[model samples]
Target: MTSTDAASPLDFPPTPAVILAGGLARRIGGGDKPMREIGGQTILNRVIARLAPQCCGLILNANGNPARFAAFGLPVVADSVADFPGPLAGILAALDWAAEQRSGIQWIVSTPGDCPFLPRDLVARLHNAQGEQDAELAVAVSDERAHPVIGLWNVRLRDELRQALISEGVRKVDRWTARYRLAAVSWPTAPFDPFFNINTTDDLAEAERLVALDATAA
Candidate 1:
């Protein structure tokens, strides 16, 4: 636990993953950003494909109509905090959902729905870093920037998170994470960053190009 070296994936517990799809999407004209297509597949599909294998269970954190995401075949849980408090609320909801529905799940990994290129070893790396730092939580970093929403959360902290969201009015992810011991695991950006998110039509177009190139190589 003293070193930051990667640990075997089996060393981690059965962690569930939740895709945060409840954003307002104001940048992309207000719709489910994960629904946007990349190389003939929805961004959600690609995210699920990458994360499903690493997690014990997978769910979608989406606000508003859950029926739209039915095609993905994941249990969609909406934010428990009203008024779209932000991704923190979605994370809180995911934690609560896991606690209630998935017995024996202690950790819940969260990723933004728009991030189709999430790392294949995301859960493993985050858990490894968490153990190495002896921290309660771990977040993903790339190009020296931290993606707070993309992290591993201890389900035991859900109650504190709920209070922070409702009573303390905390909306920023970093603001909430700062209260805990955290580990930041950095990933190389070469060949493209795994945490790259689609926020606009331009990003979607670029993702199409990247996916197409990957398909050609495959």
Candidate 2:
């Protein structure tokens, strides 16, 4: 079992990777895109496979149809606030879970469920980027762009996040990230985006091609 210990910049512990699974998926006809099939497995399964090796634990942030996603077997968590306040609310819900799970969870790496090509070294890279800095969050970046939803969120930012969800209408991820000492980890663009997300049916088709290409490449 992984020991629960306080983390330093040098010795970060096993933090949870929270999956945002509650999106409306309007472009994909309003169902769970992450649960959609790709490469003979659910997209969510691929996500868990990629991230499970990198984090101490995992949790799903879905707000609707509990039985629909019960097969994932992760602790299915819902938004604390109301009316689906977007990924920020999902992150907050995960934070609340982490706060209750143990006293030593240092950070959370948030990822959208549809992004199957996520980095293999996500946790390590984020921990490195936030090294010894006064950073409350670290998000993944590629091609000079930041994927705000795919963030390494520190537990220290809990209060601010709670206040934001309660008092202010903080829906935009980048806006909340703006209040933190943040950094980004960049992955080269060629075969993988590490943040390639399927937002539409066309996007899923592209993912199918990518998977086929990988099959041939292998």
Candidate 3:
């Protein structure tokens, strides 16, 4: 897998989506960050609303309190490897889950829980980049930054990823992506940046302000 190549929309589903909700949101006073409200709606609801239309199906990759997400109408998978293994573990979990769901789930799209403004065309764009390439992982790229975890990862590398998690102790997003034929799908940045994530209270407030602005503009 070369560093320059990545998968695009020339791919298909049963490609399920995995929302990486495993992180402990210590910055927002320790409750569920996805459940935090902005503009009369919970972030979780907004995320599902946006993501539901973009992929074949959705799952929350969270460990504790999977029952709280039962209303979402999708499976909630825990990290099968071990100890807060990060987004890569979530990706592996999603892949394994997809494999169990059907025979030909070649791809999976992922996004962060706190990113309210996730890409609307994420699945299509990533799938296009794949374009029949094997071992390729497609990811979103905007403003010269690669959102590695927000990606379309092929399920063929699931066992390799499991080994990395258990044996090699690899945790970084880029490290995992580097192991594949990675490609970046360029998205325009000014009007929308899909990788926007809310980590602090100030960021949430700003998102609320933006939501308000969007409402007025509409």
C-alpha lDDT values of all predictions: 0.87, 0.81, 0.78
- Tell me, by lDDT, which candidate is best: 1
- The better-scoring model by TM-score among 2 and 3 is 2
Worst 10 residues of 1 by lDDT: 1-10
TM for every model, in the order presented, reads 0.93, 0.91, 0.88
lDDT of 2 by residue, 147-187 (tens): 99998888778878989877998888998889778887676
Q: Rate residue 51 of model 3 by lDDT.
A: 76
Q: Which stretches of candidate 2 lie over 4 Å from their true place?
A: 1-11, 215-218
Higher-scoring candidate on lDDT, 2 or 3: 2
Task: Rank the models by lDDT, top first.
Answer: 1, 2, 3
User: What tens digits encode model 1's per-residue C-alpha lDDT throughout 1-218?
Assistant: 22223233466899889999998899999988888888888899999988887888799998888999888888999988889889999899999998898888889999999988777778888898899899999999999999999999999999999999999999999999999999999987757777788988899888987886555532
Assess candidate 1 and give its TM-score to the true structure.
0.93
Error of 3 at 62 (Å): 0.6
